[model samples]
Target: MSSRPWTILGVSTFAQTAASASMSGAPFLIPALHHQGLTVAQASLLVAAPVAGVMLTLVAWGWFADHVGERVALMAGLSLTVLADVGAAFAHSHLLLGICWLIAGASAAAVPSASGRVVVGWFPPHRRGLAMGIRQMAQPAGLAVASATLPAVAAAYDLRTALLIPAAFAAAALVAVAIWVVDPPRGERTAHVATNPYRGDLFLTRVHVVSVLLVIPQFVVWTFSLVWLVDGRGWAPAAAGLAVSIANLLGAFGRIAAGQLSDAVASRMRPIRWIAYAAAATMTILGLIAGGPIWVAVAVMFIASVLTVADNGLAFTAVAERAGPWWSGRALGVQNTSQFLASAIVAPLGGLAITHLGFGWTFGLAAIPALAAIALVPVRDERPLS
Candidate 1:
């Protein structure tokens, strides 16, 4: 079966948007819970539970996509996500909600792994940077939905009903995957290698290091950016949420733009060298954002988000390119595993850093990872580091 790149792109955008709504749901839900008398700390746990669940299953889903096709995994994941949303809607206890969220987290993870595999499979090498970026945009686009609707829904109606949007969206994606998703012909791929790859050892391979290090900053921003806005800049939840939403919207564009730019580079490093540099420069600017006015800080956050997330596709292309067709799934699996493991640790650590150090340090520390990813880039062709 031959799949259109655009069709796979559509699947990615839709599925990611739906799953991303869940990512945005936590911060949005916190406000609704605050109105219900829950403390900010307590409210965040509701979201965190599911995220932890997602971290646990990320690698598993990657392996699954490597073995099965991206289409099958996406269909199953989205269907399960719909069901999990139903459970989340009904769970009265925080414990049950945590469990439901965990289930949702694991299921939601499938979209990233599956969506990415589809893009890498459908597009050619020259087109992959842009294509993967387009695919990565689904994240911020999805966040935009959460930002725009989640607060209003939880406010006007109950939190239960507010979640229905993601549920319905997931259901639609299930059908879309069933009907629309297909693998491209082998002839369409840029370079054909093995048709099967192993999952266990993809991590120690040189190229996978970029995937590991890139997530350090990604998790940092994702976990703490809202906290910084509210605590550091004194922005309200509505304002903070909206700012984050806007940042995500712009961030989506950044992914596509950065992807295209990365592809344009002639270096064997492709995006790694460039992305590493951009991430450091941008995050450094963001750390300095604390002294600026709120609106400016907001803009900085948006821009930083763009830089932070830009590496999403470029790194994936490296994996697919280096690993060959058979290894893409395992490669992606390792990528997801490392990124989310960092995410799981970083998310809570972000919260802790705010309580201990000041807000500036929260963003400032991310530079460490940005530099690390850059350093990981091989300086010479076929050198050891890459």
Candidate 2:
């Protein structure tokens, strides 16, 4: 009870988790829409809003965290996100839905920036890897909640209530952070200094490169898995949601274990490389196997989810360590920006891929990024480009 900021971290984690869980509603959406008589054109636009919203503001949030400090950024963003979520629930027009989702996407950035800053600030350099890893678990945990509960809630109650669930969750995080998250005191002069990583000799050039490379599959599988399960394999939304939820449960543990392994191993990238290799191989195999049987496809995706995401913790830790303290926030922000930017692209492309190339070949293309990430793991710290 005394060490309760961690619980605050837990709440912060929940906010992010809830935001991510929103994708679960994607698969359930059309059925709920039958009552509204939404045309394909309108449904497409609404489905695209959250993805667009997240991409639009992710960089802004990162920049703010790099300059202003995470606590202020997180509180501000969380407040806006709560507003966005609640307001979206009541939105009656298509235009309002898009506007609400865009705001929600933008607001969601606050927690990651602030929470990451907290882990970076409090944890020592060596242990920072593990701390950051623990923080990443929020995503999978949130995805699990969305996948497991959101659709069911929508079916039993209504889509508005389902949307409200995550809104309330984000609100809880806002209140918890307000009460519990303590910012490290900086000298009046150095407070701004702590926010940016550009000044130092310690900027992580290799870490940055690897970060951009690694985020591809994580983003791909994350954004595509449920849609792939439902569209490609013909699984019901409820079933697909459950499968992704299980995959996310595995991912939550994978984040912690990857971080610990990064600290314990003599070489940080070694285990990371192995995880990348596994993800690539799994994707390739699953992509080829997708046409064979539904159960087989389901099993393959679940396995691929585990292998693909296991490296997220190690990746963040590597960037933080390589950047050192002065540059950690900015370094991580750059890392996130690259990855999430890719995530932004992946969603629409995935939709197009399913629309055009069919899921089999599009999924096969995703494996290419995983393999590229695996190949890059051999690179060591070259001189900092910065």
Candidate 3:
């Protein structure tokens, strides 16, 4: 075996991390937005804009990766993300800011499906779990960076200046991807022979639904943790941000561990089901303690954050593997689209829930989706990869 796959994995991880920084990093700005006089729901709407953009364009980018190539898609997408982020930095009004971030997220949508295909294409079945696990680390790693820096910067300087962080990362990633990303070779196919993986079964659909269900709890924790710490528990913004950042780091490690477990068991769906159970239990525990002592709430929130996210890499790998090369890009795109579609809605609704119901009730309600996801995990549909 060659070291090329490892190198490619590094580039893919960086590209996705940059994109994630630009996309998933918006919620970190909610605290800053609050300081600017926006209400909770309004601030959440701004945070949801990028995710809505991501939901809108993921499939098209997947199609592009399948038809053109991963390298072109990566370079083109990252470049546009950099430009959009730059535009967002100078936006004067909330509408303009939302639009610019929407554009950034739309462009950055290229990273997930394309980079995912790159990993699936390069790594063989035996090593794919670990590889995808490392690759999946990008989201939380990006979030960790955002958590540690964005709130602090916005507090110190201005929101506009803090907005530049994602752009800088995307620009750096563009350079790396242009220099290092070579699209993996594809198998030759006859015009009439390519088959659609979705036509014959409900496996991919079930996985997508399960992912959608699971994302609600994940986003509930991720989008609200800092605010919950500050607004609900009376912590300082910087300390809350630090705590959230540490939680994200633990979540990242949790994903890697979940991936390794999948490799060991030779089943992605199994671990996902188990994680769903853990996520349900954690969310319930957090809800029970949401109004309790500050220390207990913070600790439970951290654990909920970690458990809620552990299923992402496993579900992603299963979708790509089952979809095969001919359909993996589109399938993975669907997977991301379903999750982000839920994510886009969760912010505003969750904010409203927290507003009327308080953190305790809202968090208690978040457990419902996680509980639902446990039953839809599609464990029996799994087949061993080569």
Candidate 4:
């Protein structure tokens, strides 16, 4: 492949990293907000607000990408996210803050929906798993950034000021997308395309269902990691933040590794199936040792975080390849929408579980979806158009 595709991947990664910063940063703010005045339920709702927003518009953004192309879609989405982040920074009340984050979430949906299309369009089938893996790294990369910086920023200045960090990330991504990203050439489309991906095969449906199931444990860990570290482990918030940051950093590498593993094995579903099972096992172990020694808990959480995220690149590649170039955007959008909807539920449900049932039981229960995902993965792995 030409360097052009790599260039596009670089730009998309930056934009995705920026888009993830704001949404991922929200969970880090929960402790600060709870300290200020909000109840655990209210803070959990705030943590979930962006994902809820993403759920509302993921398909729309995907459709927009299909119609207008990746560059335009990403630019518009990032621009809107920048505006929303700025508004969120100045928000005076929790309601106003939630509203702004919701808008930002909806806008940020464009990054994943469109960027996946960009990769599938530019890279050949043989190279796509690695490319998608690199592209998928954007979220964890952004989350790592947020985990490393947001807690300290919120601690030193205040939660409101901390909001500016992601706003800056959004603005940076906006500029990058405007200057660098280009839609792939039109010839990438397959000859006999479906009018909509949903109409043709059960492949896309299976991928979507598995993705939703897999996301439950991922979100449960992401949503509660910092608080669990601090409250359950009795570590300082900053120290907990550092651990989460490390986990996210490792998770980024895990995504790339999983992608390469798929490419090596020549089967996307193979790697994803293994990842799901690993996620279930690790999460179960983490649940069992929830109040164990600090090193042990951190070790299990780190492993769980890596395994939970490892499936994204593999699953995304499967969807894009199956959907073909024509429907890649919308198919990916649907995939993400399903995952985000699950993620939106996870925050509140996990929060309530943490409050009432304790982290041990919640972590144990979170593993069931991963087990379900393992069962779902045996459905056909071939591209729908092939």
TM-score per candidate, in order?
A: 0.87, 0.85, 0.98, 0.97
Q: Write the per-residue lDDT of candidate 1 for residues 60-91, one digit (tens) a residue.
A: 88788866778788888888899998898898
Which stretches of model 2 miss by more than 4 angstroms?
1-5, 22-48, 185-206, 324-326, 382-386
lDDT of 3 by residue, 1-386 (tens): 79999999999999998999998999988989998999988999899988999999999999898888899999999999999999999999999999999999999999999999999899988888889998998898889889888998999899999999999999999999999888887789654335787877899999999999999999999999988888888888789889999999888888889988999999999999999899988898898999898888889988998899999999999999888777787899999999999999999999999999998888888889989988888888788777
Backbone atom clashes (below 3 Å) for every candidate: 2, 2, 0, 0
Candidate 2 residue pairs that clash = 17-142, 197-327
Candidate whose lDDT is highest: 3
Q: Each prediction's Cα lDDT score?
A: 0.72, 0.67, 0.91, 0.87
lDDT of 4: 0.87
Tens-place lDDT digits, model 2, residues 335-374: 6666666666665666567667776776678888777766
* Tens digits of lDDT, candidate 4, 9-91: 99999999998887667998888888888877779988899989988888899889988899999999999999999999999
Q: What is the TM-score of candidate 2?
A: 0.85
RMSD of each: 3.8, 3.8, 1.1, 1.6
Candidate 3 lands at a TM-score of 0.98
Better of 1 and 4 by TM-score: 4
